[model samples]
Target: MTSPSSPSSSSDAEIVVVDLFAGAGGLSTGIAQACEALGGTLGEDVRLVAINHSEDAIATHEQNHPWAEHYHAKIEELHPPDVVDPGAVTLLAGGPSCTHHSNARGGKPIREQERASAWHVLHWIQQLRPEQLLIENVPEFRSWSRVIDGEATNDGAIYQQWIQTLQALGYTIIRDDRGRYGVTLRACDYGDPTSRRRLFVIGSRTHKPTAPEPTHSADPEDDLREYRTAATIIDWSDRGESIWARSRPLAKNTMQRIAEGIRRHCDDRLAPYADVVETLGPEDVEQLQDDVVPIDDLETAVKERTEPFLVTGEVAIADGGVTGEEPDPGAVLVMGQHSGAYPRDAQGRPVPTVTTTGAIHHIAVDAFVKPRNLPQRGVHSNATYDPGAQPAHTITARNHDGHLVSPYLIVYNGQSDAADVDEPLPTVRTKARHALIEPDLFPWGLDIRYRLLEPHETKQAQGFPADYEICGDTKRSVRKQIGNAVPVNLARALGAHILSWNTPSLSTFGGGVTADPETEIPAYAEVSSTDD
Candidate 1:
């Protein structure tokens, strides 16, 4: 086999990259794309070597990027090839498994074995001594504490020690003047549709690289470009074919519970409307039931009946009308507009944070109420009707619970209307289960149902090329791979920034150099054999 770091040609000035713990080649692909954008020939001027423990992930990576050298072995079993000079390697990049350090994993005691995985990156750094190293992981990794001899150290002792070790090894770790290592970047800030936040640490042997500037912005004025919404990237034509499009019938018990919740919501909203009726005299109440009195006229009658209760001296009712203490015998009733009971967002905005599991909420709309003339026999109006204009919530793995993953409630406006809605898709989670409510399915009632997102749709949401193949036998495995992988556009933006540091024109942004520190490394923080 060829050496991992061997150049394709002697004449090519290649930027050799090794991605440790590489997942499905996200970082590798980004780096290569960035290099190509900056005039470097991929596979020639930019060589990639990806290492991951999962045979499935490695298989997917190999299928997508056959040119890159791949190793399906644990990081502990890998070493630099003797044919390559460690100093000649241009860059080393990796994101060790962040499960142990992730905030989502909760504050479990730091596992010694898992914490040691981070040190593996250091081991490679010691061997390769690459010019630049980029480490990506959960933001919480910076605050990870060390457990030495079963005793906990300082809150950030582990991360601080890692930095000091690199500094001692003749490298400059990028940090703000305040000594904060790693910059947190949101994927949407770089124009990826998904909203994923990741922490990145850059260590350089020669010069410090500036963090990439935001190309897209949440605010209109601050960004060079508007944030890319999910609608722009997702293929609406194939939406019906998505796994999420098919109905996953809810359990009978679950459906009953949802119906009860809806009933309760309707009751709450109707309280004030019912109160107006209570204040009416028998004749007025009969008039209201017969539609002889307009709703406004009934409200006026109710107000007149309660006028004596008005604490305010003024008798004339304003637009909002009289609102005060009740009269002893006769008080005019006041009616307030019913508030919506659901959550929704406009289609133009970014989606909520995508997680391992997806999010589903009822589409907020005007609560359904029985017509004053109609008998209150059954639940007629549903608050779950879809407006067909709001974006999706965060995507997650499980969407089986109707109470938790309350699918968007859609009421058929007309029989001729299509089921399609022009709204942003939710963040794609590992399970990729999303749902829609079809009121048309049941006679004058809403039916909540589930569907799965196609693997390609999930990939598209993550800013992967439409043609990118996700190699996995099971849909669950494929969805998991897509959810865990970094958004390709985000990776490209970061890669471009790194490449900029090497280019003369782009290097002017920060000279690719860190300012000389006004102070020295503290004496107590000196690197030692035990620091590991």
Candidate 2:
């Protein structure tokens, strides 16, 4: 075992990263970016070498990150693990194949073939022994080692076995004593407009005794922390406004409803579509216009918008040319430069946290509950926003496709610059944005009524470069990629804390802080003896 003591002269040269189970390279990208943020020279000598069991995933990784050497075979296939030079590896990071530990698999016995294949990561870790290790997974993994009271411990039983193996290899352990890690995280915590939370574990063979600190918190009493909400990261379209930025796609049913609502509200004032034309700054409105073409008439435009929002399959919007009444829904609609709307629940606040389970159908704007009944009341979250602060929580893909399900965001509610209570939602500033919404009014009645997030838009919400691709065209593949990965920004901030030479203070919403310092307990805190 190595301690984080004085480094050899060679240590300053470079640091190599080996990404095992490198699904679409989200973790690797985050670590690489975080290293860059550390403010030092990094190059080929200290770079990423990613490996994954899926050939398609490897290809996807290759497409985006040509610098990294990718291995398409399973980790166990490494004859002496020939993926990369063993001695050059500085860190090993990834969340392994989570099927066995996932709740979705449900009490069914895992396929022996897949189970056998999954163990290869442990084999690789044992063989490589990189200086540092980072692992991420759902919270239930804490008990994957054993079936509790014969209830069938799919998550706990397997995790216990995995950790035991690591423990045997002389790795230290750190888990959330209160088990809060797996909850959603809003992206605004790290200067992002969305809120996304993830469960992370960082261990090192050579680094000092340190772990990642909470860069964001839901508590309010703590100083130096700001509450990040949907109002913070306005949609790239709504930049400069105070709302969580969003570019998420809405579900078909929800899209229909939204278009109907907007149309109804603006009906009497509905002018010719051309009359409201606006340009997206100096840039040719062509780019934004091409996303959705507006019809000359209002009813036609509603139908055009509904086609993409409601249909699960792709519907190409042709040339985005001005079409007459009774036009094809497949025709593309052009959108002029305009501020985007806030994804809200029935009461007109931001939507609640979305999950891959119903990826598309649950799109409702969630809001931090504030009583219109009493203006003096504090913020309230209906299973969304922080209980104490004003910002969103965190945004993550939380799906296998690497598509963003729910952007952990705070619902921003306030008087507009016009001092009007009912002003337009703030525009976002980030490049490439999409909004999420419920598929239809009766989603629970039919599971088939699901929402589909555009692949590119999903990547943007998860903090991937705008052009990044997940390497699969199928829904199952895409959703899986999004669900399996970590929130890159969240990981980056946490990594900074773990890698920092000094302790970092919390920065998200200070809603997690306890009012009584001596109490050592907060309202939402769930203290446990097993935190070590």
Candidate 3:
């Protein structure tokens, strides 16, 4: 894949942006990067006036962008015309409440609630009236109709109405070859690394046939760079297998085994949402539903096995020494292997592009259970692990029934002879298990061996700064934030291209503007750094 170019060097070359419905500032963040690439600062001449209804999302936006003024109330509460610095505003962008347009747009008997959200995009644009405007929504919005009677005719003709209003306001409409609303841009084509296709409406004072020529391309051999992959920003330095700087020690043997499995069992190393079920204990199954495990409890288990115990005989304990026979074959062995990967930090390669499925979480080898006595159970710990060359499956958000579908890595014993078991094997264990498991045997110990991605990981992958705090503490809220925000890197890439295409004359404006900054003016917003 082509490496991303360096940020623009001139501070005075900034471009200003105003964001409406700016949930968690994904679009703003991406625009910031683009400004940087074009040799400009996001806050100086290039500003981002962001607005969002969710307090939690706005809070996150403020923490990252202390300079930008944020409105935490509904879009209806504020008068955008009063807040904008007209002359300096390069872009006016809004992705209004699209839930209705996306989920219930064409459904029969449209409710009144649905109509309001779908029609609000243009309402906000009229108020902010920047030099340019862009609207993003699901591909389905192209054919969306406001329902009237039980049947679906053109219904309210939402698409036609939007186009007309934009034109009436002297805005030009640009459509991609696909004929979707605005422009049909494949995010991956711009080297986002993820296949997130979005419908964008870009208009400027001067009518243009298209939005902009794509700076990045999907086909490596067709003039554009190769598309990026999840590995690009994974930060695998300390963690052998990650794209980032953390380390989770995998057994040398285990790594080799996993590699073999990937080659033999998987059709592709980066299988998206390929499901694998490790024979989990009743407790793990419970933890999956509950969404948490006692960290202290799991950590203690790893501590005990730091050094393989002499399980053939009794060992001394601080409380007292106890003697014992070989461990029973029936006793399950839980191994705590190292599963470290990824050191999250914004300074690393820019995060992967963001997506609607950004809320999806992955399963990881957070903790493992290794029985203190392995020989008695005829199990041997793997000694040679190689993470750098190995990769786990890709993770996606859509659920399969109730199961959070994602990739899995499971390991089972190769020995299942009658001699190993004193009693006949249970019938249930025989039929259900990973193929890696020996016939008639259940997977006794499953480490992350390999696992799916997590929402936090997804956030990192999607170009949010590593430290970009996803506001709400609840999983559902976190998912919403992640899912809603645009990928900062992708936005930045596109922003930089716009600046390159339109090298407008520059002016100074780094400090807060006056009560009424001119419609076509530039000013800086001064800032003081804090150690905190």
Candidate 4:
């Protein structure tokens, strides 16, 4: 076992980091950026050791961060001493597998079951009590409770216990205005293209930690930078092929959606075969316009503001453009043919173009939820626990129904079906659910093209640079690594806040304070022992 050598010289100013469950180096990249932002050189002043069990993930992390040492073993399998000396680690960071606790949209599991949870992290923390530590997970993780007698005693009972234990171990957790133990942040607020909401629990042994302030805003009135758009990260060079020249013809339902998209989104609004217009600035107009020579109707030709609209159809175009197409069924936007939405090649790389029109804002499926007041005797969930309400349902002997689900998240609520190219992306998922909608901006007769958002695109959206390489044997694996990452910009913001605290009340070598004297436990806190 070759462990990283301990601190060559005992410089309290140096930063040593060990990233547990470091998926594709997102947090590591951000932390390194934060360190460099503080004027330190990599490998000399700041060193990193990344840990993960996934082969491809560790390979990806090693590819990007060559300066850092890596341990390709599960968190529970590796001994802390064999990985690195506890005394040398200044910062310990992790994003333990959230597959079990995260909402449906949040912790979509990778095929290879990765079951390490906060317990593994807690065990490791007990072994390597670094001066500062931060944990990242889906916001719903705040509700995780320990299972006792096959039932949860209370919501967040486990999390509260974890925090109190850390506090007892001489750490000060960051708190927000609402007295929440951690800061909850949106990725896009820090200029990341994806609007993923995540919870970050930051604790420091030295000084009080501050939450990073938002640097971008949805509101234009704020002095911060405007949120970035999906169009910004895309490689426009691959505009896709002409709609008429596909190897396989477009599907009937898909063509129908395309026609509707044309009617509602384009038709009178766009010049099918004209010069592409320059993207408009906010100061530009009531609706974004095209200055090209449609030569006929300048009024009808301008695109109706942001994002590409329903593109085209040979049937509709041949029929002289929308002969009363059912008042346009809200622009037929269906998901892709594959289970995860991406079409792969002989080797699993996501193809840039496909035969179909792909997913667009031109169509919508009527979303439905089971009526809350169906005049029913049926139980909404097993956790609701009126066994009488659902007498016919299987009653498990364990009775740990609350552990079965977390009925939380805004999967479709408050979010658009498809975001405009000019707007921030919807939350990136573990699967390739996000698809591209490319409009035939000019007279190429291509109409609009669709493809799953490429891995590189999603990576850049997470604030990783274009050169960052993601390794995987298959397409799903590659996408999972990218989707599961902490947004680099958001992590950088958090890292900056922690690294900037220069003066430690006591040496990290000798711990002093244990949490804030004024720190308030969260309202959901049930600070009780496991045996209680």
Which candidate number has the best TM-score?
4
The C-alpha TM-scores of every prediction are 0.61, 0.52, 0.54, 0.63
- After superposition, the stretches of candidate 3 with alpha carbons farther than 4 Å from their true spots are 1-14, 85-88, 103-112, 149-156, 178-180, 215-218, 232-452, 499-532
- lDDT (CA) for every model shown? 0.49, 0.39, 0.41, 0.52
lDDT of residue 252 for candidate 3: 36
Instruction: State the weakest 10-residue window (summed lDDT) of model 3.
Output: 421-430
Better of 2 and 3 by lDDT: 3
- The candidates, ranked best first by lDDT, are 4, 1, 3, 2
Question: What does candidate 3's lDDT look like per residue over 208-315, in tens digits?
Answer: 424555545434577865544434433322111110111332233332333343333333321221122222233333333343222223334334433211111111
Candidate scoring better on TM-score of 2 and 3 = 3
Candidate 1 structure lDDT: 0.49
- lDDT by residue (tens digit), candidate 1, 1-532: 1234443332355687788877766677788788889888767777777888877788988888887777787787776544235776788888887766755433455666876778888888898888888888878788767776654463877777777777667676666445577787777667666556677888776654568888876466784776665444433332121111223322332233233333333224323322332243333323322432222233353334422111101112223333232111112222221111112211221111101111122222221110100012222221221112222222222211011112222211101111112222343445544333221111001122223335665576567788888777887777777766766777888888875675222222333333335333321221223323
- Pairing residues by index, what is the TM-score of model 4? 0.63
- Residue 260 of model 1, lDDT score: 35
* Per-residue lDDT over 1-532 for candidate 4, one digit per residue giving the tens place of the 0 to 100 score: 1234442342533888889988888899999999999898888889888989889899999998888888888888887766766666788898987655655423333322333367788777778778888998877677767555444333776677678777767677777787777888887787676556788988887876667889988677999887776556655444333333334433332333333223322333232211122121222211212222221221232223233222222211112232212121123222221112221111211112111222222223111011011112222211111111111011011111101000100011011122234455545555554333333321112233434445776677777899999988887787788777888888888888887876443333344333433434422222333344
Tens-digit lDDT track of model 2 for 351-379: 11111111122223221111010112221
